[model samples]
Target: MTKRSSPAKTGPQHLVLLAIDLLDSSLHYPGDHPPFESFHFDIHITSKAEDEKSQVLVTVKIGVHNENITRQLGSLTINCTFTMNNFADVVRLNADGQPDMPDDLIETLHSTALSTARGVMFATFRGTFLHHAILPLIAPGSVTEEKRL
Candidate 1:
């Protein structure tokens, strides 16, 4: 008789929230002039678990300005929220149960945006794991705009 071995199981509970932060920078339009200003982005990342269908939610807030006029004629604000699924598939697990990021996942996140809107924005984001035990990431805030052109 021969003995049979079973495959190792990777569960969802092993996932953890690593780092969350925003990259805010202004872009100037036309040589040395702030004609059009734009705020960069915000990102939240989580450690990948064993589930291949696990999803992660990312929320974004943007501020826009049109400096073509002199009296702050107009401004725009945008709020965006998106979900990235199958993130766990981009996580590599070592023998010690540590999570490692895959190149594909980084690429996907770098080029992903949730939604966009115009004029002072506020938003709340949440992520639900299907058939798994995972908590959603939530951010509640109001983005305000004040400019004097």
Candidate 2:
């Protein structure tokens, strides 16, 4: 059965960020093109749980593309590992016997990971052609909708 027992207010105290790693990133500008008139962002999120170790890894990948999206301006991929003190209690097997994660808990992790990527993107793109192109504040619900895993 799906576990819905996790408290809605799963605060930061229950989750500890163990690490943040820049799995990949790239910046490229077609030299002759006019300064990006406008750009779009493509974001992807995925999560893996190691319940035995009370750890969860959330991966956030963002891509910056030109107005037409025919070309990619830049991209960033970040992986965040978090430790939950109540992992066993929070994550439980669903009716299918597959691990089921609480929505609140998943949102929390995705938010944090995305925010971290935003900051890192700013720093990494600083002094570059895409310097002014910053990641906007994303609602967790919108972000979670893109999650594939």
- Per model, state how many residue pairs clash: 1, 0
Best by lDDT: 2
lDDT at 131, model 2:
87
How high a TM-score does candidate 2 get? 0.81
Worst 10 residues of 2 by lDDT: 1-10
Worst 10 residues of 1 by lDDT: 125-134
For model 1, state the Cα shift of residue 131 in Å. Answer: 42
What digit string (tens of lDDT, one per residue) describes model 2 on residues 18-68? 999999999877687666666689999878666566677888899998765
Whole-model Cα lDDT of every candidate shown, in order: 0.31, 0.77
Query: What C-alpha lDDT, on a 0 to 100 scale, does residue 31 get in candidate 1?
Result: 42
Model 2 root mean square deviation, Cα atoms: 3.7
